[model samples]
Structure formats: structure tokens, C-alpha cells
Target: MSPRILILGGGYVGMYTALRLQRKLRRGEARVTVIDADSYMTYQPFLPEAAAGNLEPRHVVVPLRRVLNRCTLLSGWATAIDVAGRTVDFSPHRGESRKIEYDVLIVAPGSVSRTLPIPGLAECGIGFKTVEEAIHLRNHVLAQLELAASTTDQAVRREALTFVFVGAGFAGVEALAELEDMAHDALRYYPELKADELRWYLIEATDRILPEVGPEMGRWTLEQLRARGIDVRLGTKLESAKDGRIVLDDGTEFDAATLVWTAGVKPHPIVRHSDLPIDAKGRVKATSRLTVEGVDGVFAAGDCAAVPDLTNPGEYTAPNAQHAVRQTKVLADNVLAHLRGGKMGDYRHAYAGSVASLGLHKGVAQIYGRRLRGPLAWFVHRTYHLSRVPTVNRKVRVLIDWTLALFFRREIVALGALSEPRREFELATRDK
Candidate 1:
């Protein structure tokens, strides 16, 4: 009988691993099944562009059903993993929970936003992790602009137009920059609004932003943002956000309708369900070969696995797409070797630096010790991610979107009603 291979999460690791196995596995060599809550895998790097109206939201996500045709696709969440029993508890989108047993398990559920217990944060703050959040943010920002334009109350207008982003990582910096540019361009439509009236703030707890690009490039990026009139508060932290009232640890307080949190991430909470060996940081322990440490016939990678860094030694690979995407190649190969009684290879790739987009035609990058900025870096950023976006279908669609953007103006239409499509219908049905 062929062994059953069950994969959790359809993000970078799970999807790519299943895709590789589908192509290499002999007929009926193994039964591969992928489980994820969402039916599509979001290309997260393009999320900023999607939010800023540079790319359509649909083009940024790859439909799992269309790509993984040979693998069994289950739309659900893994409630628990009984490692010893070799079974996982799963709850589908519209069904009761059940147990799924597999001969080999691949845990790659990925990570979730790392949030804090700051007051009012849960009620007022938004995250930038998924495509849904990206679109919602775009609409919300534009809606805020509309509100400010119509309001005569100065306090209300100030609060509505103020935007605060905490944590200066790639997500925070890129999202803020893109949306700021879009909003600035949109001011021409609102005769009552001025560009300087829209306030943007980037607050980071640490002393630096984009630490991946090294200290030198980080400083340059900081200066560039400041030159564009963005108030960057480094070495600071968010104290409270109760009711849109932002309180910083450095004795600053303000009200903002939009507060974006991109601080960091933690491994998916599902890891606790299994008895797998984990690191101090709650990530599944993994060796250089991508297999779960001390576990037989099981593997893990991506943001959830703490795979030791061989090149740097004494450190684990940083949880990012560059590493996650590359790790899948070695992971798929090693999985097949383990299943077919062949030799397993180790996963090793030196840090390739990082690239970031600071709105259209502006970017910063450090690759192979070579630093670039401005249009050249921006072009390189788009080119590199386009090459890695997976599937020619998505690549072509995204490229077409970029081409059209050059000849067209950005769409600032706020579809806030999409969030509550049935509200108007329900109201109409009620007696007046």
C-alpha cells in the first residue's frame, strides 16, 4: 500500500512541497493531501501594491484547487495533531470535526501576527498579513479621507486623516509608504483637502527599521522617508490605542482612525496540539535536512520551523519568503528520499539580503553585498518577486496590471459596503 502524506497549511511551504511531490512521485507512490482554511495562497509580497490599487487583489492570490490538481485539497483547519497516534483533528468550513490519520505528516501551518495586550488595540488596530486585510485597509483609508473631507469639526477631521503604523518591518514600512503615496495622489480630487493635512507616522520599538538591509541602507531608507515628510519615531513603542486614542511610551498622544500593526509574528497556535519537539520560541525544532528533529517520517519548514542556519551557525534561518520558498525545494526532495529509501539532502542557503518598495518608482535593496536605491532598485524589486510569484498565470496577470498602471490613474474608490453587502438589503426589507 502507498503511504499517505498529509500536509497542513497551503502557504509557501505546504503548497510548493505538494507541487514538487506531485511531479516526482511515481503513479500511486504516495497519496498527498493538503489542508488549509483558505482555498488560495496569497503572494504576500504584492499585498502593498494590491492595497495601493497598483494590482488587482485576485491577481495576488493563487487558487489552490487550480494548481494542486492531483493532490486532495481540504478546506479546513487542523484543530489538533496527535503525533503519537499519527492522526490530526480537522474541522472543515461547514462540517463537524474529524480525525485524519496519515503515514507521514508535514507540519507547515506558518505563522500569525504577533500581537500585544495594549489597551484598545484589538478593537481599533488592523493587521497586514492576508489579502482580505489588504483590501480592507485600502477601502478604510479612502473612507477616512472621504470622512475628513466632509467634516467641518477640526478635531474630527484631524483624527480621521491621521494614520499611525507601529513596527517598522517590511510590511509596516511598505504598506504605509504605498498607501501614503496613493492618498497623496488622491488629494487632488478633494478640493477641500490639502496633502499636508494627511498625517502619517511610523513608530518602531527598536532603534532601526528594515534591519535586513544592514545598518547603512537602513539609515538611508530612514532619511528618504523623512524627506517625504513621514514622521518616523524609532526607539519608541505604542502604549495604548483605546478607542483610537494612540498613546506612545514617549509621552505622545493622538487620535487616529487607522492604526496598522506589523510588529512581528509567532508560530501558528496549532503547534501546541502536537507533542513535537519545539524550540524556546515555540517553533517546531528542525535539523539542517528540514526534517523534524527526533521525529520519524515527519517534516516541517517555513515560519513555523526553527531550522538551524548552517551558513551563519548558532542561529536559525530568518522566517521570510526568501528562506521559506527556498527551503521547500530541499524539503520536497528530502521528503521523497525518506519515503523511497534514498539519501536525504541538507537545506542550506546563505542570506541573500532584502528588497523593499517605497511606493511607485522608489525602492531600496541590498543583494549579494551590492546596494541599490531609487528606480533601479524598484525595478529589481518587482523583477525579483515577479520571478518568484509562482505559476505563469499569476506572473502574466501581475505584469499586465503593472503595464496598465503606467497609462492609468490609481482607483481610490472605497467599497466599504462590500464588508456588509446585506446591510442595505436587510434595511430595505424592514418596515419604515
Candidate 2:
């Protein structure tokens, strides 16, 4: 019988690793299967654009089943991993639990939003991680304009016009910038709402933002955001937002309709459930070879694994797409070598650089020790991400989206009705 390989999570690591393995391994050498909660892999960097309606949500995500043709695609969650028993207990979308035995296991269940125990945050804050959040945010933002236009209450309008975003990392900054741009453009359609009436606040606990782009670029980004009328507050913490009333640690308080939390992410909860050796940060401890320490035949990578960075000693690889995507090749090779008794390779890559988008025509990038800002950086951001999105179909779709966008005005129409498709039916049924 051929060896059965089970891969958890369908993020960059899981998808790319499976893609590579299917080509490298001969038929009958191994059977591969991937199980994920969602059937698509989100190119997370585009969540901001998706939220802003700059790109269709469908184009940013790669459908896993269509791409992983040779591998079994299971749309489910891996509830448990039996390390000693050599089996994985999985729960399907609709069915009884089942156990699958595998000769090799790959754990790459990506991270989830790392949240703090702040009051009201649970109810008021939305994350910019998945495509669903992006869609919901877009709908909500447009809905707010509708609410403000139709209302005469100053308090209600004030609340709807105020936007607050916590955590100024790449996700937070880009999302805020893009969404802000959308809102700014959207205001042109709302005669009652003036651009000056909208208020945006970006609250960060640290002294700087976008640390991945280095100090100079980070500072420049802050200045740019401030210049765009975003209230950039450094060394500030969100006190609370219970009942949609914003309160800050610096003794400031206000009402806001939108609060986005993009602080960071923690390892997927499944890692803690497994009996793997974890580090202080709750990440699976992995060697430079990408093997989970002390777990035979089990490998971990991506945002969940604490893989040692050979080039940068004394530190694990940063949880970024650049490292995560690069690590997958080495990880797939190592897994294949382990199965075939071949030599394994270590995962090592120096920090190349970083890129961030500030709205549509503005950006910052630091590549190979060169710093670039403004329109060139923005163009590079688009060009690089377009190339990185998986599948020729999706790349073409995204490029078409951009091409069409260039020839036409921005599509600012809000289809909030999409979120609650059944509401009208329910109301009709009740009336009858």
C-alpha cells in the first residue's frame, strides 16, 4: 500500500506543498489529502482592496479543490491529532466523526486574530483577516452612509461618520487606508455627507507602525497617514468600545460605528490541542529542516510554526507571507525526502524587504536595501501581488478587474442586501 499523507490547513504552506508533492512524487508512491475549514486559500494581502470594492472578492481567493486536482480535498476541520495512536480524528461539515491514518502528517493550520480581553471589543470590533470580514465591512461602511443620509440626529450621524482602527500593522494600516479611500470616494455620492464630516482614528500601542518596513519607512508611513487626515496616535491603547462608545487609555472617548482590530494573530487553536512541543508563544517548535521537534514524521510551517531562521540567528522566521511561501518548497522537499529516504534541505532565506499600500496610488516599499515611496511603490505592490496570486485563471481575473477599473469609475454601490438575503422573505412570510 502507498503511504498516506495528511495535510492540515490549506493556506500557502499546505496548498503549495501539496502542489509541489503531486508533481515530484510518482504515482502509487504516496496518497495525499488536505483538510481545511474553507475550500479556498485567501491571498490575505488583498483583504483591504476587497473591503474597499477595488477588486471582486472572488478573484483574491484561490479555490483549493480546483487547484489541488490530484489530492483529496476534504472540507472539514481536524478536531484532533493522535500523536501516539497514529491517527487523525476529523469532523466533516455534515457527518459523523472519522479517523484517518497517515504515514506522514503536515500541520500548517494558519493563525487567527490575536485579540485582547478588552470590554466591548468582542461585540464592536471586526477583523480584516478573511474575505467574509472584508465583505461585511464594505457593506457596513456603505450602510452607515445610508443611515447618516436618511437621519437627522446629529449623534447618530457623528457615530456613523467616526471610524476607529486599532493596531497599525500591515493589515490594519492597509485596510484602513484602502477603506478610507473608498469612504472618501463614496462621499461624493452622498450629498448630505461632506468629506470633512468623516473622522478617522488610528490608535497604536507602540511608538511606530509597519515595523516590517523598517524605522524610516515606518515613520514615513505614519507621516503619510497623518497627512491624509488620519488621527495617528502612537503609544496609545484602546480602553474600550462597549456599546460602540470609543474610549482610549489617554482619557479620550467618543462614539464610532466602525472599529477594526488588526493587532496580530496567534497560532491556530489546533496547535495547542495537539501534543506537540510548543514554545512560549504557543507555536509549534520546529527545526531549520521544518520538522516539528520531537515529533517523528510530523512537520509544521507557516504562521503556526516557530521555525529557526538560520540567516537570522536567535530568532524564528517572522510570520509573514514571504517566509511562509518560501518555506513551503523546502518543507515539501523535506517531506518527500523523508518518505523516499533521500536527503533533506534546511529552510533559510535572508530578509528580502517589505511593501505596503496606502490607498490606490500611494505605497511604501523597501527591497534589497533600497527604499521607495509614493506611486512607484504602489505600482510595485500591485505588480508583485498580481504575480504572487495563485492560478492563471485567478491572475487573469484580477488583472481584468484592474483593467476594467482603469477604464471606468469606481464601483461604489453597496449591496448590503447580499448580507441578509432572507430578511425580505422572512418579512413577507410574517406579513402574510
- Top of the candidates by lDDT: 1
Candidate 1 per-residue C-alpha lDDT over 135-227 given as tens digits, one digit per residue, 9 for 90 to 100:
999999999999999999999999999999998999999999999999988998999999889889999999999999989999999999999
Candidate 2: tens digits of C-alpha lDDT, residues 390-419? 889999999999898898867887788888
Instruction: Note the Cα lDDT for every prediction shown.
Output: 0.94, 0.92
TM-score of each: 0.99, 0.99
Give candidate 2's total backbone clashes: 0
Q: What would the TM-score be for candidate 2 when compared with the true structure?
A: 0.99
